[model samples]
Structures are given as structure tokens and as C-alpha cells.
Target: MTICRLEVSNPAFTPDNTQFVTVHSSHLNRRHDVSIYNVNAQTENVPIIVLMHGVYGNHWVWMGLGGIHHVYERLRSEHKISEFVLVMPSDGGLRDGSAYLPTKGHGNYEQWIMDDVITAVQKTVENVTINSPLYLSGLSMGGYGALRLGAKYAEQVSGISAHSSITDLLELTEFVDHSLDAYDCRNLHESNIVYWMNKNKNKLPPIRFDCGREDILYSGNIRFVEELKSNGIPHIYETFEGEHSWEYWHTHIVQTFEFFSDIQTHRR
Candidate 1:
């Protein structure tokens, strides 16, 4: 594993440095990079939120284009919700996005996140204990990942929130140009958000997700919510004014952090 630290001198910010660790995945047979935020504080038992990125995005998407650093600063300074570690990891750059799925032979992106990525973070990041609370949020394909993996590994995370999430492989391949030959269509159909939630009904974590009014995935989000209701699963779903753009995600992710914070407080 390769480790590096980025120290930024921003007079207006409290924590000016971000650490990055690249973990070699036996599943993917490659090195995956994870960008960490706010590791300086003594966050012993704080919840760690993993922010997965959309297709065509890398680990830096949250920190760079998503302006998460600005949002983190605002939360700590203004909202006083400090002491959580933010982990941003890539999807192994599988064509478009891996959908965080495990292929038969090539590599297992799902295991890379649920197994390799989390393990690597706990080892490399200081002050992060094995018992630190975990949460997940993502957008687009990343949203699909967080929801599916969060359910599949229900015991690992405390809660999950997704924005503009793709509910199925069909919807995902519609927007991207990559061929999804590696994904099992049968498995994809079975792993649809609603399907997975139904399969893991009793084991689900606290769940919430939102979609923009103009987002192409808006209809899918609505359908998934309906399925949840029909299946007696409780969650928070809302519609906001925006589209499937960075501006939309950047503004609303703050609410996700707050939601996780609430869960953390109540659990204590």
C-alpha cells in the first residue's frame, strides 16, 4: 500500500491536510486509491462516512468537483458537527462504473469496497477504531453501489443515504457507453434496490435517499420508494429542485451528513 498526505494552506479552514492511501486489492489485481478527510481530530468513536463516486468519477470527485472540503468546513465551523472521517474511494475505474459488482473472474469490485477498501482504511488511518460507526452516501452509479452493498453487508454500516441512484443495471447502462458483459443480468434484476431490500428486510440499516425533480433517475427513485412502501420498509425519501448535476449533489449532501449525525447521536 502507498500512502501520501496533501497539506493545503487555507487560512479559512481548520484541517488543512488530507491523507490518501492506495491499497492493493487482490480481488482487482490492482491498487485502489482512497482519499480521506478530517483525520487530524481525535475521532475515536466517531462515525465514518464513505462517499462513493458516480461513473466517470475517481476518488477525488468528492473532494474536487463535489466541494466536500468546503461542506466539511461549514459543518464543523457552523453546524458544529465535527469528528467524522470521510472516505472517498474509486470503483476500480471499471468501464463507466463497476456498479460495485463482483465479476466471475476479472475482479470483485464489491469485495474491493466491502472488504479491501474498508480494511485498508482502518489500517492506514489513525484514530479510526474498528468499532467506529459507519455510514454511506453516493450518487448515480455510486448510489446504486452504496445501497446494494450497504444492504448486502448490513452489519457493517449504521445507515445509508443515496442521491439520484440508478436502481438497476438496465438504467445504469442506458446513460453510459460501456458494455456490461461482466454483470449477470439475473443477479442485477435480483439485486435491484427494492429486491435487495426485500431480501434483506430485517437486516437493513437506517435508509434515506433523495432525487432531483429534473433528474433522469427521478422516476426510478419514485418507483423504488413505492416498492419500499409496498413491502413495508420504512425510509426517508424526498424530491428537491435540481437535476443530476454536481450542483445538486453538492448542496444536498450536507443534509446526508446531518442525517447520519442524528443516527449516531440516537444510537449513543
Candidate 2:
């Protein structure tokens, strides 16, 4: 069990309950950046929440310009949450994000996260175990990653939260340029959150997602929710007053953490 290589120095402290570490992933053959925020480092057996970033964004997007750590600190301080570790990983070496997929020639980005990233975290963080509860959440492209992978790997996670997710990878045409052959396109479609959720309905974990009314992907999110409803699958879907910007994601991420917290409580 070789976790990814630690390519960076020891954890650097900041005022916002955050730490930065870089790990080299053999899967991707590159160094992957990760940002961790431990609300209570001494706490044990708490869920590890992986907060993935959207396209053109690295691990820093959530805590940096988005001020997510600040919001999370506020929520935790206000007694809205129990302590949890936040793992933010960069979608490395992709021109327009990997969509966290294992595409041809590029590399197995999925393995990079599921194995290399998780192993690196366990090795870097004290007392982290294979049996520790896990959760996933992300925004935009990250939302796609969280929802799709969360469902695809449902056995490994308790729940998932997606914000402004690209429920359908075809929707990505609006944002990125691609010259995919039929197989690549089909493979990507297969990984669509809605598609995979249906395929894994029996194993689906608690799922919640929200999108802003002003977002271009709002219709897609609504359609996805409808599909879930039609199939008798359970999930939480919300529409708020903002757009696809970080402002919307930053403000609402607290709701996501709260959702995961509630799931942890009831499952106990």
C-alpha cells in the first residue's frame, strides 16, 4: 500500500484551520496538490470530507478566493458541525480539468484520487484508517466528480453533496473544447452522474445537490433531480438565488457540511 509520494514540505499552518501538502501520484505520473483543513485534528473517527474544485480551479479554489474555510470555521464555531477533515485535491495535468475521469492516453485520474490521494492522506494524517467514514462534495466540474464517483464508489462513502454539477458530461461542450471519438464520448456519458446513479440505485448513498437559478446548468440539475424522482431514488435538490459563481458555492457549502453531519448522526 504505497500511498502517493509526499512531494512537499511538512504541513504549513495558517489561521484558517488549513494545511497544504503535495503528493506525487504514480497513477497520473505527476505531483498532485492537496489542501487539508482539520476542524479538530485531535478528533478521531470523524468522516473525511473531500471538497473538489471546479474546472480551471485547483485545490486552492475552495479555501482561497471562495473563502470556504472561513465559512466552515464560522459554521463549526457556531456549533453547526462536529469536527471533520477536508481534503481538497487538484485535478492535475488536464488542460480543462480531467472531469476526474480515466480517459485514454491521459492517465487514470480516478485511481489517482481513490487510491493515491486517499493513501497519501492516511499516511500524512495521524490515525486515519481505511475504515474511517468518507464523504464527497464539489462544485461545477467538481460537482460532477463528486456525484458520479460518489455513486460509482458508493460502498466507500456515506453521502455526497454536489453544487452546480454538470450532471451530464455533454453539458461540458459549452465550457470546453474536445475532439472525442465515439468511444471516449460514450465512456464519458456512462460516467454521467445521472446515468451512474441509476445504474447503482441500489447502492446509492445519501445524495444532495443544489444549483442556482441563474446558472446555465440549472435545467440540467433539475432534469437530473426529476430523473431520480422518476426512478424512485431519493436525494435532495435545491435552487437558490445566485449564479454559477463561487459566491453561490461558498455560501451554500455550509449547507452541504450540515447535510453530511446530519447523515453521520442518524447512521450512528
Residues 82-184 of candidate 1: C-alpha lDDT, one tens digit per residue:
4688889888877777888877576888878877777776776677778888898899998998898888777788999999999777798767886777765
Candidate 2: count the clashes.
0
Q: Write the per-residue lDDT of candidate 2 for residues 45-140, one digit (tens) a residue.
A: 657888878878998888787887787779889998866788899976587778888767777777777787777777777746676788999999
Number of the top TM-score candidate: 2
TM-score, one value per model: 0.91, 0.92
- Model 2 regions more than 4 Å off: 1-4, 11-16, 180-189
Worst 10-residue lDDT window for candidate 2 reads 179-188
Q: What is the TM-score of candidate 2? A: 0.92
lDDT over C-alpha atoms for residue 137 of model 2? 93
Q: What is the Cα-based lDDT of residue 43 in candidate 2? A: 65
